[model samples]
Target: MLPLALAPLRRLFLGLALLLPAAGCSSGGGSGADDAVEAANAQNAQKIGAADVTEKQEADARFLVKATSNALLEVELGKLAQARATAPAVRAHGAALLQSRLDLLAALRALADAKKLAIPPALGEDEQEAYHEVSAQTGSQLDKHLMALLVKTQNQDEDAFDDMKDDAYDGDIRGLAAKYYQPIKAQLDAAEEAADAAEKLP
Candidate 1:
């Protein structure tokens, strides 16, 4: 199982302005596990709070970089999975997943820029253009898919959620999620590495 290393980082991100709105989403909610995740995340943040503001900001930025990358990676993997989905409904769901990725990347970009985090050179031009192109197309596709999911989940269509969940995980969703998230994480990880090697940036 993937560790919940991202949890405390998620809540420290609550103060990040960019992540505040989405924090309400709780996976496996109403379960003891969900409660534990939240509590654990909160406690982790409090523990890390002993650090000075500058240190906190740096840590927050590092967390943002990793989380944002992971999210985008998941979306890209979803797009690939969508291409293989035999069911139109499932494919549409995949499109929505891709759109979500674009939204996440956009948010992360905004947050990183806001925090003055340095952009990696590789993502300078070509990567950005591809992101824009994919984002535009995927956004349109996701709108259609989400509308369909709404109908399906409402019982207008039988067994939609089950189908979607199955399709989402069919082809190594975990692996793909990790693969896509790596680039962004690597960049942030590099920044952290640099920070560690040098005096803290002003």
Candidate 2:
């Protein structure tokens, strides 16, 4: 019923009206897609952060456990040598070693506590066996045994600290190793000296 010109104008307006709703829908969908992409990225970042934390915690825990065990063994053996050795040099060395181990253990405990880790309450089976074997000896025999054990253990401790100082994943763990490696090396030197002295004994 409309005139020819009006008919074209009405068709054009109807076409524009139809396209407007579709365009609005397309814009909203684009915004939603962007939001989804952002959320996924944030989620992935959170997972990566958690993984990194877990890895560092695991590394730190391993170092703490091993260091604690070593400290405990050294403390026990130092006390034994202090009580049983006939040589004044051996006894003095034991006292000094005991004090050093105690200090190291105290620091390790504080660090472990802050990390929410539980330290082993006693020595391991192998350590206990070693302690008993040393306990069975007396006099020069005990001195020889103790010095040998100290030399071996001090070397191991020095090596462990050296590795951790260089390779630990956690900054704090690396710092701890760096702080103690020199002292451990010094202990190793003392142990070697004690062993030499023990070898000279009749």
TM-score of each: 0.32, 0.71
Instruction: Put down candidate 2 lDDT per residue, 88-110, tens digits, no spaces.
Output: 77888899999999999998878
- Model 1 over residues 3-39: C-alpha lDDT tens digits? 3543443344345434222222233225433342233
Q: Supply the TM-score for candidate 2.
A: 0.71
Error of 1 at 202 (Å): 57
Superposed model 1: Cα runs more than 4 Å off? 1-55, 87-89, 119-202
**Between which residue pairs do clashes occur in model 2?**
none
Candidate no. 1 TM-score: 0.32
Clashes of each: 0, 0
Worst 10 residues of 2 by lDDT: 20-29
